[model samples]
Target: MSNFTYRKDHIPKGTACNRRPGFAMKPTTITIHNTANEKSSAANERAWLTNPSNKVQASYHIVIDEREAIECIPLNENAWHAGDGSGSTSGNRTSIGIEICESGNYTKTIDNAVMLVAQMLMERGWGVDRLRRHWDWSGKICPRLMYDGGTWSKWYAFKAAVQGRLNELKKEGVASVSDKVTVKAYGKQIKDGKLIDGTVYVPLRAVAEARGDQVSWDNNTKTATIYK
Candidate 1:
C-alpha cells in the first residue's frame, strides 16, 4: 500500500468528540481536510482531540503528516469532521475523513495524504470520482490548502494525484505473489500459473487447453505435445 508507516493511536471512545455508540460508517467517499494549525503535528492533533479539557467535538479518521499517517478514529465509526451537523449527510455517515497536517513541507503533506487516499480507494474498489473536499459537504473551506485562493485547479490536481497513485497500485498488483500474477491465453484467463522471480510461469497444458488446442503427454519422451 505504498509502504507508508501508519500509527494507530486512536482517540478514546469515551471522549466527547466520539461518544456516539453503535454508529457505524460505510465509507462511500473520502473527505479531504486541512488541520489549519500549522504548528501542530498529526500526533498533536490526535492528542488534542482526546484531551478531556478540549471539547472541540471534532474528530477525523486519520491525520496525515509529511512523514507518517496517524489514525485517530476507526473507519467503521463516524467522526464529526464534516461540519454537516447531526444530519444524515453523506459526509457524516458514508465518508472517511482524512485531515492533512499543515506543518512541515506542504507538498510532502499533500503527497502523504494522496498516497493514503489512493491506497484506501484501491482496497475499497473505489474510483477517483468518490473523492471529495470538505467544502463539498458544507460551505466551510475546511481543506483550506486545497480550496484556498478561490481557484479549483488545486483540487483537480489533488484528484489527479490520487488517480495516478491508484493506477500505479493497479499496475504493481497486490503484495502477495498469488495476487500479482495473472495468466491468459487467447483472451481467456487460466489459473495454472505462478509468478517466480518476477516472471510468470504457466503450465503448457493449461495454456494449450485455454487456446482450444489438444495436449498429449508422452511418457517415454517425458514431454508434452500440443496440437493446434
Candidate 2:
C-alpha cells in the first residue's frame, strides 16, 4: 500500500446547463501549479470546488499539502486547471494537474508534491520528462514560487528531486546483476562475483550457504554473522 493518502471529492462530471461536458483525457504530462492563495489549505481547495455557490469553473486532479493530498477530479477526465482553452494543445485535455497548497511550510508542501508526482509517474510508466510547470502550456505565472524569478532554480530543483525519487523506486524492484568475475572460498569456487567501481562483490547469501555456513543478522548492530 502507498504511504500517501487520497481524499476522493470529484468535481461534477458531464454537461449541465451551467457546466461543460466531461471529456476523456489520456494524460501524457503532469502539470504542476501553486495555489497562489497562501491562505488556502488543501481542504479549503477541495471544499471550494465542491461548493455549488462558488462559481469558479476551475478544478484540478489533486491538491497537495505538507500533511496530505486530496483528489479533486478523476485522472481520466479533463479538469479546468490550465489557462488554455478547450483544444488539442490545452493542458486540461492532455495532462493531469496537481495544485500545491501554500498554507503550511512551503518547502514541506513542495516535497509532498514531488513525492506525489513521482508516484504518479511510476504508476503510469512515465518519466520525469513528462513533468511540466503551469507556465509551459500557458503564459500565466502560476506556481509563482517556481517561476516568479528570472532564474528557474527552484523548478529545476523540484524536477531533480522527483527524478531522484523515481530512480530509488526503480532500484527497489531490481534484484541482482550478473558480471564476469571469479569468487572463491577455502580454495573452492563458490559463485561468480561482479566487479563494480574496481571492487568485486559476491552474492553473500549464495557464497555463505555454498560453504556450509549459516548467516544471521543483528538488526540492532547492523552486522551479519556467519557460523558453521
Candidate 3:
C-alpha cells in the first residue's frame, strides 16, 4: 500500500452547470496535466472543482500534491481537462485526468503522481503506452513544466519513472501478469512458463532437474517428488 493519503471529494450528483456532467467512460488512457497554479494544494483544487461559484467547465479526476491525492471526479466519468471535447477517442472521453499540483514540494508531488499512475496501470493490466499527455489530445502544452520548451526530455523521464515504479509494484506481487513473463531461478532462465489466471507457472520437473535434483513420479500415488 502507498503511504500517500487518498481522499474522494466528488462533485454533487445533480449540479446544473458546474463541471462534472455524469458522462460515463471506460478510461482507456491516462492524461497528465500540470495545474500551473503553484499556490493551490490538492485540497484547494478539490475545493475549487466542487465549489458552486467556479463556473469554469474544467475538471479532472485526481489532483496530487506533496501531502495527499484527492479525487475530484470518479474514474468512470469523464472530466473536461482535455481540450478535445467529448468525441469518440478524444482524451476527455477516453482518458483519466491527473493534475499534479506544484505547491509545497513539487518533486514529492510528481513522485506521488508516478506511484498513482503506476498503480492504476497495474490494476488495469495496461502498459506505459496507455499513458498520455494533455498535448497528445488537443495540442495544448499542458503539464507545461515537463514539456520544457518542447524538448520533451522531462516528459520522457517522467514516463520512465512511472514505468520503473510499475515494475517494482509488479515484483511485489500486487499485480497479475497479463503478458508472457520470464522466470529466472538459480541463475537459469525459463521462457515457456504457463500463464494461468495471471500467475506464471513453471514445470516442477524441469526446474528440479535443472537444479540437479532427482525427480520421481509415483504413478499410484499420483504425486511427483523431488530429491535433492
Task: List runs of model 3 lying over 4 Å from the truth.
Answer: 16-18, 176-228
- What would the TM-scores of all predictions be? 0.73, 0.70, 0.74
> Tens-digit lDDT track for model 3 on 1-228?
335877678887665354787888888999999998989999998888767787788889989998898887888888888999779788888899999998898888888888888888897888999989999999999889898889978899999999999999889867632246577877788776765323478889778867889789999999999999
Kindly report which residue stretches of model 1 are placed more than 4 angstroms away from their true locations once superposed: 1-3, 17-22, 175-228
lDDT of each: 0.78, 0.76, 0.83
Encode model 2's per-residue lDDT on 1-228: one tens digit a residue: 124455566656652332334687778899999998888988898877767677766778889887778876667777878888889768979888999988878777877777778777876677989998888888788778887375778889899999987887677753221235777775678456774322578877767887888899999999999989
- Winning model by lDDT: 3
**TM-score quality measure for candidate 2:** 0.70
Better by lDDT, candidate 2 or 1: 1
Better of 2 and 3 by lDDT: 3
* Model 1 agreement with the true structure over 1-228: per-residue lDDT tens digits: 334467677777577755434367677898999898988888888888867798676778889887888877777778888878766665877788899999988788888777888777887678999988889998788688776577867889999999998899899773231223568789998776775322477888888888899899899989889997
